[model samples]
Target: MPELPEVETVRKGLEQLVLNKKIKEVLVAWDRIIERPNIEDFTNQLIGEKIDSVSRRGKYLIFHLTHYDMISHLRMEGKFDYVQPDTSVTKHTHVRFIFTDHTELRYLDVRKFGRLTLLPKNTAMDYKGIKKLGPEPTPEEFLLESFNQQLKKHHKAIKPLLLDQTLITGLGNIYVDEALFKAKIHPEQTANTLTFDEVTRLHVAIINVLAQAVEAGGTTIRSYKNALGEAGTFQVNLMVYGKTGEPCPNCGTEITKIKVAQRGTHFCSLCQRIHL
Candidate 1:
């Protein structure tokens, strides 16, 4: 799944490439990708809608059109490619948005798990998935006091609680592991057991880790790439997400991998200790 940073990267790329380009036509090779309205209605309604801007909430991308807000979720292997009209449409290409300028924004998903929903203009935030999001992982929106209070209400293991997107949105398995590692909190630690000092460290860690990842264009894991067809560079700076046996950067201890809430989790045993 493309988390906030990856989704934000795609939003920025789309803003530059597709803004103000009126929709000449929309082609859907896979009908299941359109989640809202009938396929015929979706393709027909977008015929003259111009791409005004692109925004992101959590892992969802919102394309602000002239008459509607198109919410897209790139579930697993979904991605968009901006190309010319003559560009070859691959077997994986499921949705194609042909612009009046002759350029194309093609959505390709190997797993076919992506979805698109068109709602009234300015109503994208009220969508169920986006409505429940905690907040963007930033200092301005994600405050320490509120986070501490939320932690006190959850006895769930910290990792899964964070992954739930109700505590702090935008943290997937990768960034969650990294943030916990930076805070020196074990993934299995109960959320309510955390000390205020610990929570403070975690609060800062989440914001910093996500900000840095966004700056680096998000971590390129597996098939993830921005709309510009560029892979992210943050994977190179990762400490322990995929490093099972590597030396821990801070303590020289070998990193460990374990399953928490059925998600693969990585942390340094010496650095991150369980509080349970």
Candidate 2:
């Protein structure tokens, strides 16, 4: 799963190359990828609309168009490629946008799990999934006090609650495990049972992990790449994400892997201990 940094990297690349480009036509090769209003309606809403801006909310990319907003989720293997007008369409390229300038914006997804939704212009922020999302980790609204309040509101294990998009958008299994490990908090520990100091440490871990991941263009564990198809560099800096049995870089403790929320979780038992 591409988290905040990976999604943000895609957004930045696509924004620079595709923003202000007028849409000449839209091609939907895979009908299932179109999730809202049907494929015909999807193409109708996007064709001839100029892209005003490209932004990100959680892990979804938001393309602000002239009349409507085109939101896309690059779930797992989805990627956008910018090509010239004469470029040949490759296999697995499910969506293509022909620009007035003779360029192509192609969305390729091997797993075919990516989704596209078109909402009306001047749409309210509370539209469907957007309505349910909590504060962005990087946004000014996600302060330590607000984070503590959110933590106290949930009695479940801290790991799964952090993974909840309603509490904090874009956190996935990898980032959640890494953040908790950095804070020395056990993944299965109850959220509201955390001490004040643990809460403060968690706040710092979330911010630091996200900010650093962005700096490295995101952690590419598998097929993740930028708009240009370049692998991320953060995987080299990871301490506990995928290092299951490896020794921890900080304390030399052997890292361990467990399943939490049905997701593979990696942490250091010596670092993140649970009394329960």
Candidate 3:
């Protein structure tokens, strides 16, 4: 699934490619991807609206139009591509945004887990999914005390707590484990038991790791790609994620994998000391 960095990359790409383009029509090859007031209503609302700008809130791609906001989530395999008027649509191509300029914005998803929501432009914050997200994980919002407060309220394993989109948005399995490993904190550690220093480290790690991932365009773990159909370059700079049984960067001990919150977690046993 595409996480924060991946979604943000797509948002930026879309902003550049589609802004100022008016939607000539919307064709929904998969109606189930439309999670709003129904495909017909959504299509009618967005038909002639101009795409003003594109941004991201949590993991959803926010496309601000002249009259409404079209938010789309690339749940798993969903991707957007800009194709010429003569380009042929492929098998998994589910949604197409035909532009007045003779170009088309195609949405392709092999897993069919994507979602699209259309809401009023001025009321975008009132949208249910966007309304529930926590603060963005930028430098200004990652205070140590605030992070500690949220963690102390959770008795669940740290990894699972971090994966909760309600607690702090834009984190999924990949980045949670990566952030934990970078902080030298074990994935299975109880959230409530984190020491003050551990909390501080974690707060910093989340911001640093995510920022770095965005810079690299996001981890090209599998199917994730930018609007240009290019793979992200962050996978090469990873420390421990998907590197099970490999030597740890900080210590010579091999990294291990275990199930935390039913998600495969990677950590360096020697470096991420338990009960520290």
Candidate 3 lDDT at 11 equals 82
lDDT by residue for model 2 (147-241), tens? 88878877899998988788788788888888998899999999999988999999888888988898899988877889877788988878898
Rank candidates by TM-score, best first.
1, 3, 2
lDDT of 2 at 76: 80
Candidate 1 lDDT by residue in tens digits, 20-111: 99999999999999999899999999999998889888999999999999999998888899998798889999999998888999999999
Which residue pairs does candidate 2 place in steric collision?
Answer: none
- The TM-score of predicted model 2 comes to 0.96
Q: Deviation in angstroms for 163 in model 2? A: 0.6
Q: Point out where model 3 deviates above 4 Å.
A: none
* TM-score list, all predictions: 0.98, 0.96, 0.97
Residue 57 lDDT in model 1? 89
Stretches of candidate 2 exceeding 4 Å from the true structure = none
Which of candidates 2 and 3 is the stronger one according to TM-score? 3
Ten-residue region with minimum lDDT total, candidate 3 = 139-148
